[model samples]
Target: MFVSLGNLQTLYLHNNDISSIETGTFSHTPRLQRLELYGNNLTSIPQGVFDGLNQLQYLSLYSNHMKTIPPNTFINLQQLLYLYLHDNEISSIPTAAFANLPRLQQLCLSSNQITHIQSGEFSNLPQLRELQLQSNQLTSIPTVQYQFPELIHLNLHNNNITDIPANAFSNQPKLSTLHLYSNRISTVSLTAFTGLANLNTLYLYNNQLTDLPDYLFFGLSSLSNLRLQDNDILQIFPNTFTGISSLTYLLLNGNSLKTFPSEELSKISSIAVLYLQNNQMATLSFTAYDMMLSDVSTVDISNNPWQCDCQMVSFRLKMTGSNSFENQITCTDPRHNRRLLKNINPEDLTCEEPMIVRFEKGDDNSVEEGETLHMVCEASGIPTPDITVILPSGLHETVESGGRVIVEVNGTVTITDVTAADAGLYICIAASPVGSAFKTLSVDVQSKEPATVTSAVINITGKPESTLGSAPIFSLPVLLGSVIGAVAGTVLIGCLILMIWCKRKAKNPPPVPDTSVVFNNTNTTATVTTSGHDQTGQGWSHNVTNPGYAQRPAAPQPTLDLYEDVEPPPNRPTSKGAGPKQPAKKKALKPPKRNKAPHDERPSPPPPRTGAAAGAAAVYANEPAAALDNLPYYQPLTKN
Candidate 1:
């Protein structure tokens, strides 16, 4: 119907309810340079929608329900330079979809539902400079090799892209900037950015990269600014930024970097301003800063966990005095965690001597299993370096040195009764804020005979016994326990011997000593003697009387003496009614019974001396019984 105005230069049929377009719908608009049909009821664009509009340079089909972009959809509109297909329901772009648009400088499909695209889908757009496909459902680039020789800026940010395959920009000689930030990118191929010779800026911040490999940007020679902040980067290789000499601004903020990349930073000379803020770096030292990069305008190492300790604290103070890192540096350690580094006084940065650690100055050691192992490590530093031993089991053990496995306060590791499981490489770390040193000691516990270990002593100063030829020193507790055990065994043996002797003596008693009493008439003495039970001989004598035997009283006691008195009744007095009974014959005294109680030992009296003179008998016949009773007590000898 509008064919009457044949040479229409611009067609503004936007906000239309165009549900369908006939084949020749725009045949009469061949000279149409701009087409504005956005906000339409069109579900899709017809194949020949812009058939005769070869001069159409602006095509705005946004706010449409377009589902798919077919190949050769714009084959005739070679003059189309700005195609705005954002805010559409476009799911995929087919191959050769934009092959006819040779001058399309900005093909923006942002804010669309595009998830997939065929390989070489944007092949023929050689003049496309800025291909913005950000804020979409793209998980990855459509193809590995994107051939855009004239494309300068490619924005694929805010997409669901997990990876950018290798050689994604293989032929992009004029590509200067690339924005792939805010993606789920966890990995990038080694050659992913190998061919970007003129790429000056790259924004890959906010990704899931754990490490940056060496030579990642090998061919990014002109790369001046790189934004890799907010990534989970824990490690960066030695040569990660080797060839990127033009890297003036490197934003590595918000990472897990504990140590500085000194080697890589040394190679990058043009890094005028480097951003290493918000990392796990414990301290910033002069050694980490490259002296060659003196021309570096500034290096922002702020917001790092700066441990203000003796370890290179002097150097940190020196750097704090310089204004190059003025306002950008702040501490994250105790007492000054949020304080600025420049505000800390240089005098407050106390330091001790550097540390030196060694394993008694020896090489790898070997020991037999089931033997005592004494390993010694010593440190030389101010305020004494604290020692930690990392065992073969990968467990860090603080050597408090006690018991059988004693560790001396000066770093001596003594392991008594070491087994095969205790064999391994032991790393001794002598660390302090001043400095730290490490020594590796490989202990090979061999399974051998004798169960004896021959380990040399490494003394207090870490002097190896190989040179001194000294035995390994035993801990006090170990020696004490051994001596105690031996003494207890000896005491036990002595007690057992004593008990056996006692039992033998109770079973068979010793022979009784003979008791013999002799009376000497010449000396008028009666003697008593006792000898037994290893007792010395002893004697006591009593005097026999001339008329009557007057004797000293025996020692008074509860029990009777072994030889007590036994007197017969006095002879009956002669009377008229009683015939004079013959004088009772005087009985002779007999020896007391052996093994008898003192009260029961009643010895019989002996017969009168045979054939004594009749006159002598007449002297004793009147009171013979009385004479016998008058005799001195004849005490008997007692045995032990």
Candidate 2:
């Protein structure tokens, strides 16, 4: 075992047949700083083999058969900075194994059999700047609350890590590059990267992420490139990319995304390249196209299941105008299926004899004033026609099947919770690539009436032939029951609507009138309490405490006066319920009573209290929108 090399500062014995290092073999090399024993047949390193190498800073033992690292094997190597133990059979890093190595900045334990690393294993390496634990059997990163302030790069790719907890990268502000791709990560907390303020490159591709959490990238404000391709993400929340405002390249290819992340992408103006290939999206929504960025130099929208139909007519025009990705996009549906979108003509995109298909309910197309109308226009075409409905009120609603009204990709129109406001002629424009068909459906919303006139007064505008046809015979008792049910449903629905309206009004109360305050004395400043919590220390009361005002003589002093107590408006309940009606609390400090002598008076009311005016706006803290945000995140209203 050659233990006589005492003054060795560097030793290169790599690619050797050494199967084992004897105890005390390195006892003589007290000043060893660089030790290269890589590509060796060493199965085990003795406990005290490196006990005397206190100056060891570089140790390369990678590509070896070493099954385990003995406790304190490198105990005295306080100067060790670079430890390369990758491509080895080492399974786990023992607690305090690399203890006391203050200068150890780079640790490469990649390509090992390590399944778990005890918490305190890297705690002693305070100066660790780069850590590589990739290509291992680790199912998760060790739970550690340590702040790695100096760490810059961390590679945990090709592992089995399933989840990242909140503040997973805590306090590593200098960390700029993180590679966690090719892992099995499915869930990440909102604060997973809480302290990664300087992170610039993040690779989470080839994982199992189904949906991105809200504000997922909130801390990486310095991030420039983000790779999240090859995941199962179906939709992105509006502010998922809250951070990374300066991102230039975002890769989202090879996912299940059906809707484009227009809102999130629009926040980042520096985005130069955008990848959205291989998704379930047929076409971009109107909002997405409206916010299309100009700085995007390259866009990859190819490989998606694009439906080239009438709804796409407008989008096709935009797609054609977008010469950058025009040739890349293609249709995945009938007729034009597999055809390049750029090659399709605008005249070729129209509907084929599109006409209304009267269904069971609303068969005659005439619906009750309160009942919903669900209708579909059947059109014979290769690619199904897209339906766009225009209401009588000049409101052009592009139907994509949602909301109080929904337009499905299959030319179905649904008007949920309809009312008299919806009674009018609705023009349904069914369009495909071949041609378009316009059909006018008149909706005569009938009003509620007595049992005797229910059949006679009910207007029917769907078909003249159907209305002229024989009316269905009904018994007197059936007619009575129908009328009773109609009245009951109307009353019940009206009550529910009223209750909902009252609840909303109570949750977000309107602002009260301005409470003006005039400070006649310049010797003191008043700290106005804007929060209306109570009467004394809190409330709508303007507290004017003038310690100097009390010094004035009592006679002819004009005390600061307040108006009458604010009463709750009609049918409005106060926040704390009605309190005992008493004199409204006003500031005790008062201005000198008109200075009795006219010569001493300024002859005008003081300027309006600017402070009171500004503070009034934020007095109500429990606004409905703020209260609702704590309840649940908003889901997609509707998508094409």
Candidate 3:
């Protein structure tokens, strides 16, 4: 019962049990604008089914059992603008099935069993704008030239796409929005969107992309909103969005990124909202926020796996102190953790073990004299471990040299001023409350001088003296010579004494005019007398008297004049009357003076002397003059 209807602009044949649509089914309906055949049990679309319906603008064939479409099914329908085939059992489409549908604008093929699309299947649909192919088994989109030139929206959600081919949408210059969520896309090619200049929104959530390709959106100059949540993206390329100048919103939550590409993405001045929550990032670079500028207001980078290594300790402090970073970052791993990074204290993120701990000798093999061998122990530990050096002599010393030892946390010790006695097993012990370790060092000492003895000594003696006793008997002459030598020595001593006495008398001579004077000898006393001299050298006699002798008259220029007129004392004897029993009278005398003046110019006479005085003066005169030789003399002046 195939009936032809004229001037039909709409037809409805929904909810039928039709299994097949024969060719030339609508060949007479040239002005048909709309047709509805949904809810049918169709199995296939035969060729030339809508050949004469050139003015058809809308069509719906949803909830069918069609498995394949024959070629040239819609060959003459050039004015068809809408097509709906949702919830079908179709698995394949002929390449030229829509070649004549140039005016098709909205196509809905969602919830189908389509597994593949041959190239050039949609190349002739130049006016097609919106396409929906969600919930299909498509592993990839075909890359055909001029396939959908006016395409503005595409929906490819819930597909089996593991890889996106390069330039997949190169022919779609007018594309603005694309949806590829819930797919198995593990990688995106750099030219995935190479020709999509008018693209604005891209949705790629719930995929398996481990890394963003370089320049992934380079040709998407009009891209604004991007959704890439719930992926296995561990990292992002440094230039992921280099040419996406119009991007303003980006969603990167629920990924495995250890760090964000904030620096690279922020080059787009129009970016405002960035969602980076649920990652494995530990720290954020300072340049990350600086590039965002004023256009960015919110950033959600919470739920990430962060580590508390020393290199990131400072960064952790900064993120905890600031409101923009710490408050937004959340810990996702090690399940028993806080919601926000700011809530977890920094002290809780302490390091567990030291990085390096060891000892090194300056010269590992040999040492020399006067050269100090250094033993250096270095360690790096958390909270600074204590370092100490134990010498072989049971002594401990602190490290001070700059290069020999260094303590990152107090686990460094150095020993200096090495000596031979210090050559033994040296130990460097590094200890902390947590644990301790030790390193052993063997020191070899070398010296030029032996270190055994301190000093040495030597002694010597002369031989015995020789003798020749009874050879010569001429000893008399030798004895006589010895006596003569002794006499000559005595005479020489007497002469030396006399010379000394004369020198002393010359230095202090006796007075020439005094009457009474005293002199001393080595064994006796002596006295001197002199009378006043006359100018005429006449009648000016000088006399010297002794107690036992008369006064002696002065002779003319005589050296000595003595007269013995009285008897000598019984106890004393004169030189002429001396007996063996009487000692000779000892006397000291001065040489007689020579007169050169007359008697008229003589000095006045001296006072007379008593007998007792004369006796005392005589005793003084008889004494030797050797003892008085050193005394000074005085002379009286004569009156004119």
Candidate 2, residue 548: how far the Cα is off, in Å: 99
lDDT of 2 by residue, 515-622 (tens): 333343464354433222221222223344445432211221234223222322333222324324333333332222223335444445333232322211212223
* Quality of model 3 by C-alpha lDDT: 0.66
lDDT of 1 by residue, 209-289 (tens): 889998999878999989999998999998888788788888899989977777667788777777888897765567664
Q: Report, for every candidate in turn, its global Cα lDDT versus the true structure.
A: 0.70, 0.70, 0.66
**Number of the candidate with higher lDDT, 2 or 3:** 2
Off by over 4 Å in 3: 1-8, 18-31, 46-52, 285-295, 306-326, 330-640
Q: Give the clash count for model 1.
A: 12
TM-score to true structure, per model: 0.54, 0.55, 0.50
Q: Write the per-residue lDDT of candidate 3 for residues 1-640, one digit (tens) a residue.
A: 2366767888888998877777767766667789999998887777667777778888898898877667777777777789898898878777787777777898888898888887776767778889988999988877774467788999989999888888888878888899988999887777788888888999999988887867888878888999998998877777887888888899988987766676667667888888888776765655664553345777776666654334344455655354575566554334324456556666665544433366766647356655656555776554334577777897765543254233332443433455677778877776644566677878777664433322232222332453333343335556568899999999999999999999988986653543323222334322335433333322222444343432333444644233211223344432223223322233332333555345456543323332222321221233344432322122222233
TM-score of 2: 0.55
Ranking by TM-score: 2, 1, 3
Best by TM-score, which number?
2
Order of the predicted models by lDDT, top scorer first: 2, 1, 3
RMSD of each: 23.2, 36.6, 35.4
| Candidate 2, superposed: residue stretches over 4 Å from native | 1-8, 28-30, 285-293, 319-322, 352-640
How does candidate 1 fare on TM-score?
0.54
